[model samples]
Target: MKAMEWYFPKSREELAELLKEEGALIHAGGTAIKEERIKSAKRVIDISSLPLNYVKKDGNIWHIGATATLNRVIDSLESDHFLVKALKCTATTPLRNRITMGGSVYLSPLWSNLMGPLLALEAEIEVLGRRQGTCKYEELLSDRGKFQGCAVTEVRFPDVKLIGWFDRFARTSTDYSALTVTIALSVEGESIRDAKVVVTGSKKVYDRLSGVEKALQGSRLEDVDVEGISRNVNVEFTDKPAGSGAYLAEVSKVLLCRGLNALGSAR
Candidate 1:
């Protein structure tokens, strides 16, 4: 077996220089750095000491640094925040303490509880290195190859007040979710002004249900057909130990309707 080389860069400039090295991978919380995943990598750059572990609200945007752990981010938000709801259901308390926000977003695994909510929130990811600016989360997922040498610096999202709902399906509470659904809506009076819907653990890893969102937009919350819209959600799932692809698709529809109804009743 080839020995692994590790580099600890305490500053952004130092981290940038290390990123230029061939076959180098960033190690923040180290939760996602499995041996099989890094078998071809000969170098690991540890950026835990960098000044990137922060959570702050600036004006109408919430900024979370790359190295901030899941628990830290959850603590920074309101008890009812969508992110807190989703993140609390992620892994376990011990694991959440070790899973960093950047690592989860950077390598959005099939079971990730973060991606669906982030997509629903239309969050922007800030990176340093090859890509040194903020880009929509969907854009990053679509063209991840272009960010090979990049280091995710921060994730920021609008602080708008939206009714949020999150749900995950797993045999056990601590197990990876077979399917996850997230919904956010802006309601005025009895009408829905805007809506965002997202699902994870699908064949595409994650998907934004634009069709569903469009159907909910400008509709009276009480009149919206949640069940009908959920049944029409176009998504493909891959078979997993928890359930078959067909089974998951059906399950997703049920969860979507339940989540939407829950949000609708919240208003």
Candidate 2:
């Protein structure tokens, strides 16, 4: 590995200016950066001092600062059960203490424990730099180039009244998941008025199961066959240590059914 220069930016403006240089990368928690080699980056711009660590609730939206560690998010957002579950699933207590939400959102690695839940909640990200603006989480992940000279400033999630559940398949609780599933639904009486299902490690980084959502929407919870509905959901996978693509697809389907069933059947 080559020696890399590091710079600490005290403000977003300074961070943006530093990013203007070629071969520059933003260092949030430094968790992911430590794991991989940024061959193209000669300088690392640290944004931790920019004061992005925070969690605030405003009416219907929850604002999470980019540098907020996973543990901080767990303690700060008390009402988001799914968020709590997902954060707890990530690494161990020590790692969670260092892993920042912005780093995870930007990395979106295969071992991600947060992406699935964030997608299910329909979270939006606020970035600073060339493409400085709020964009859907999926959109940002889809074209990471948009975040090229940028740093994630915050993540926003709606504080809606909905049933949500999250589950991940792994050899052990601490092991990275092969696949993760999250479900959020709005149930009116016994019928589902709206539904959202997100799965990670499915052929793509994130997949929204539209087929499953359409099938469950407007359906009476008790009458819906959760397992049968899950069969209609299709999830592909890339070749990874977890299992073969076929095996992962099957596991994703089973877990999706279980998560959706738990959310739908919840009283």
Candidate 3:
């Protein structure tokens, strides 16, 4: 390990200017700057000391600060059963403590436990100093890697009328998931009016699970075609010797079914 310089940015504007200087990684919770070694960063800007670590909810919008730890969000969401289910189904307690939701967005982790639910909920991110504007969650996490040198200010999730269900099939609860499925279902009178299904950890960078969403939309629970559900699914996966596409597809199916059965049927 080498001696690295540290800058403590006390404000969002200060953090933005520091980011413009280059070579420093935005330190949220100080977990990834050392552990993940994101791009061999030498200088670290401690964003934790700033005012970015807050979780606020006002009317229809939930505002989560950039440095807010996952545990904080989990604790807050416990009252909202839907959000609580999503957090509980994410990673284990230890990682959740160190893992800031902002870090997870910028990192755009492959087997991310956060992206699945966040994407389904249509979360929007606010980045400063580089991608210095509010952008859609998918846009921020796009392959262009807009978040490479960016610092997230916060993430905004608008309150919606959908009941969300998140399920991840890990080797174990403590282990990082091999894959995760989040289903935000809009059901009315035993029928799915609309659906947003997001699948993380596929052969591709990330999969939106548009196929499953299409099948369920406007279809009654009993009318959903089981055999044809995955036919048009645009799923892509890297063929790791350990986990093949077939295995992920199977897991996706099982988890999708579970989400649908729980949330899809809920009135």
TM-score of each: 0.93, 0.92, 0.87
TM-score winner, 2 or 3 = 2
Error of 1 at 241 (Å): 1.5
Order the candidate numbers by TM-score, best to worst.
1, 2, 3
Please provide, for model 3 over 29-74, each residue's C-alpha lDDT reduced to its tens digit, 9 standing for 90 to 100.
Answer: 6555555575476787888788878888989999998878878988
The regions of model 3 sitting more than 4 angstroms off are 1-3, 35-40, 78-83, 188-190, 230-234
At residue 177, give the lDDT of candidate 2: 89
- lDDT for predicted candidate 3 compared with the true structure: 0.74
Candidate 2 lDDT over 39-147, as tens digits, reads 7678988888988999889988999998999999999876558878888888888988899988888877857588888888889999877777889998887888878
* Two-way lDDT contest, 1 vs 3, winner: 1
Q: Poorest 10 consecutive residues of model 2 by lDDT?
A: 258-267
On a 0 to 1 TM-score scale, where does candidate 2 land against the true structure? 0.92
Clashing pairs in 1: none
lDDT of 2: 0.83
The models' CA-based lDDT, in order, is 0.87, 0.83, 0.74
What's the alpha carbon RMSD for model 1? 1.8
Q: What is the lDDT of residue 183 in candidate 3?
A: 76
Worst 10 residues of 3 by lDDT: 233-242
The better candidate by TM-score, 1 or 2, is: 1
Model 2, 153: alpha-carbon shift in Å? 0.8
